[model samples]
Every structure is written in structure tokens, then in C-alpha cells.
Target: MPLASDPIRALHSLLRSTLRITVTDGRIFLGAFVGTDKPMNILLTETEEFRLGPGENPNGRFVGQVMIPWKMITKIEAQESVVQTRNQLDRDVRAGYIM
Candidate 1:
């Protein structure tokens, strides 16, 4: 199947199902792909708290929230979902859903 035929599915294939997002301003957030708009903008929820700065001990950790704009994103890392989705898509295409 052409990559553009199913852009959302392609995104589901390309982007991390479990994303580790780092904001340009140096904040780190991780969560499931709750939502997104084209141009790669994203929305993530179910975030956990993380501590900033280079430190040996995590003493000043603060509760973090999800809802960062894509413009603030500096990096995104894909996790287990990459392999899982690829395998699943392969199966689906073999069954003729993706053609």
C-alpha cells in the first residue's frame, strides 16, 4: 500500500505508541498518543512527574502535566509500539485490510 493512503495509520506506524517527548525548553514528558493534528503536532495524556537538572538524587521532583504544544517539542522517541505496530500492520495487509 502507498504510505499516504492511510496517513493516520502511517502515523500510527511511524510515531511511537508510547512516546517519550522532550520539549524544546527542556521539559520531558511521556505518555500514550492521545491525539494529534497534521504537520506532526501531538497531544499526550497520562503523564508522570520528572525532575529537571543534572542531579544524583531526585529531590525536587514536581508533578507534571500533559498538553504541550508540538512547537515546544524538541525530540520524540518511539518505544515498543514501533515493532508491535509494524508486525500488526504486516498481518493486516496480509489479510487485505491495507492494500
Candidate 2:
């Protein structure tokens, strides 16, 4: 894991790919898999939420920029690799992604 905690990977990945993330609550989000943590909490942007939960409002809709808790992540599918452009790297550097 260790992919969460900031916006670098989220921003970079947002530029490159879309992700299908499923949560334990039976909610699924199709969006850019922007960030994740060691516990596998997820962050997504431009999301369409497929609500399978009990709540009606949360069922089958789109939500922008969502954070899924570590306890909630069930699965994630990425159709393509996340690209790391030079611009992204520069941003990462400025943001302290550098070691």
C-alpha cells in the first residue's frame, strides 16, 4: 500500500487512468485511482458511484472526489498503468515526493 496520504499519486494517476474501486459496503466507484494508504484506503476523482448499499441516495450515482476508508475497500481494477509524466514528477518533487 503506502500510496495514500497526499495528492501526488492521485494527481498523476488522474492524468493517466481510470479505476474501478469496490468498497465493503457494496458501493463501487469508477474513477481515477488517485491515492491509497498502507491500509488501502482509497481516493478517487471524477467518480460514478454504483450504490449497492441500503441508503437510496448513495445507490447508483456519481460523486466527485471521494475518499474511501481502509476498512471499506474491497477491490480495485485498473485498466492501464498510471503514467508518470515529467510534469508530474516535477510536481511530485515540489510537493516532497522526493526522498
Candidate 3:
């Protein structure tokens, strides 16, 4: 059986969506997905940073637009709607729904 492909398309589908990204240093960033490069570096607009542990701020600091190195990222999360879309895409690919 062939493996499902189109990872690039899946990443593109995440554009313009709100994402919660966690980095290696235990900081979380919430931002609007804007851009990415061949290296997988991410660019986000209307960004905010939330630090964990002591001195945690209830309201995240406004960071405007920022570029996050892909290597620094530990995890990325999207809203339920985006997740559903991704899941559907996976199912469709597995079912040979897309050519």
C-alpha cells in the first residue's frame, strides 16, 4: 500500500489560521499563521508570547509579527476546525479521494 502524501499541501492549508506553538524553552506563542520557508521556519502575525513557570503572565505579551525557527519549536497546535480539515484530508488521501 502506498503512503499518503501531500504534506506540503497540508501545511499550506494551515495558513491564516490561529496556532498555538510551543518552543523548547517552555514558552508558548499564539499567532496567525502567515508564512513558512523551505527550512520550515514559521512566520506569524499578531503574535503573543506566554512564558511558563514563575512570572507567568495571564495576558500574553504582544509580540506583533515574528519569525520562529523551526528547530526551536517543540509542538504546534491549531483550532479544532483546522484539525478536522486535516483529518478529512488524511482520510480522503487514504481512500484515494484525491488524485
Candidate 4:
């Protein structure tokens, strides 16, 4: 069953769960929840660390670990596949179409 089949429920679930977000430009941000007064704008907090390596750098001289509110965010990734699925459903519902 698709999440869009129940838009309200999907959104409720999303709001209730903590999210592991990957921001635009491939930066990861984890937060407790999201708030969006406008569909295009979201607010999140409780972000801790950022990782910029494929693995522990062998050189140990690489630039990794950054703070929150990076300057290159273009989108927010809902870490779980179900979150993505629910987001898609929410969009579909908002569009008055179900998929």
C-alpha cells in the first residue's frame, strides 16, 4: 500500500518520528522533527555533526566534520525509505492525486 493512499496519516507519522535528513549538496542533518509553514520552506534543529568522508580518512588530514546550517542546502532528504515514500504520498495528496 502506498502512503499517499492516506495522506493525513502519513503526515502525522512523519511529524511524530525523528528524521535523519540529508540536505542538499549531500550533507546529512539529523533532527527530531520538521516544521514547514510553507511547503517549500522547512525548519529543523537539534543537528549535531556532519561527516564528509566515504570512510575514516587514511591520511587523517582531510577536511571533515562540520556544524549545522551549512550554506549549500538545496533539499532535505528523509533518511528512511518510508519517509520518502510518505513524502511522495503527501505531495500527491496535496496535488489531489493518489499514486
Candidate 5:
């Protein structure tokens, strides 16, 4: 699909960007936003899982790239969205979700 016409293609622009994703269970995942899908599922690389509350280390655990379901997501936080900023106009981002 052409970048001009592709939906969900903006996810590519976030490549290598840091993101903080919160799930329904109140756990937070901080990682690089790599991709997503039609259902709003997100793909994050170099992830860390954080539980809420102070005194709990923000950098508690590190995991590899994580694929989170749309239904499980409660929030997504990024410093900025490339799609919103419209930077890297020519970059092609691919969205992949297994299963």
C-alpha cells in the first residue's frame, strides 16, 4: 500500500522511539514502539514492565519486544507521535502482529 493511502502506516514513524504503555491490570510497559495493527494492538521492543506506586523501581524488569493486545491496553504514552508531528515523511513503517 502506498504511504499516502495506507492506514496504520504511521506506526512506522515511531520506530526506535520510546513509549510507555499501560495495560488494564495497571502494569506499565516502557519500550520502543515498533508497530501495531487494525485493532490498535501495539508492538514494543526493549521493554520493561513496571508496577504502579512509588518505591517500586521504574526499571524493575526488562523483557524483549512485547506484543500487547488492544483489549488489554488502557493507555499509551509517548513523548510525541511522528504521525502527529508528520516527521520522516518518506519512512516506511510495517505493522506486524502474529496470531
Candidate 6:
């Protein structure tokens, strides 16, 4: 399918960006957003997993690439730079500024 819609294009623009994903098990993953499927399963590379359980290491461990099922995800956050860039672009667009 072609990525012709605005939302799809927006998502595409975030490709290779850093994302923080929290799972239902209270573990968080920080990785580069690589891909996603129709089921919303996310694929990430150079990932690190941080477990918040007792006795677990506060410093995240590198987990390499991972594919997270959408059902297990509780929250998703983009890196601050990505969010700020998008926000600024939105503001500029609203102000009739286009590049």
C-alpha cells in the first residue's frame, strides 16, 4: 500500500528516530523506530531494556533488535528532539510557514 495519507506520511517521517516504549510488565525499551505492521507491532533496533523491578539493574541493558507486540505496549514516547522538531513544524505550518 502506498503511504499517501497524512498520518502515514507523518509516521514515515519518524523512521529511524529514537523512541521509548513501555510495556505492561513495567519494562521500558529505548530504540530506533524501524518498522510497524498492520497489527501495530513495532520493530526497533539497537534497543535497550530497563527493568524497574526490585533488584533489577537501574542502568538499561542493550537488547539489540526487538519486535514488540502492540498488545503488550502500555505507552510510547518519542525522543525530546523529535517531539520538539515536530512541534515546531506544526507551529510553523499553522503560521503559514512551509519549507
Candidate number achieving the greatest TM-score relative to the actual structure: 6
User: Each prediction's Cα lDDT score?
Assistant: 0.65, 0.68, 0.85, 0.54, 0.73, 0.85
* Steric clash pairs (candidate 1): none
Specify the poorest-scoring 10-residue window by lDDT in model 1. 56-65
Residue 72, model 4: lDDT of 48
Worst 10 residues of 6 by lDDT: 1-10
Q: Stretches of candidate 6 above 4 Å error?
A: 1-5, 87-99
**What local lDDT does model 4 show for residue 48?**
42
Predicted candidate 3 versus true structure: per-residue lDDT over 1-99, tens digit per residue: 111256676777778999999999999999999989999899999999999776688788999999999999999888977768777877787699886
Residue range 3-71, candidate 2, lDDT tens digits: 344646444545437878788877788887667667666777888988754656655677899988877
**Please, what is the TM-score per model?**
0.60, 0.53, 0.78, 0.45, 0.66, 0.79
Error of 2 at 83 (Å): 10
lDDT of 6: 0.85
Candidate 5, residues 5-77: lDDT per residue as tens digits? 5545445656678888899989999898888878877899989999969888765699888999999988887
Clashing pairs in 6: none
CA lDDT of 37 in candidate 2?
Answer: 63
| Per-residue lDDT of 73 in model 6 | 99
Tens-place lDDT digits, model 6, residues 1-99: 122236666677678999999999999999999999789999999999999878999998999999999999999888777756766675677589975
The best-first sequence of candidates by lDDT reads: 3, 6, 5, 2, 1, 4
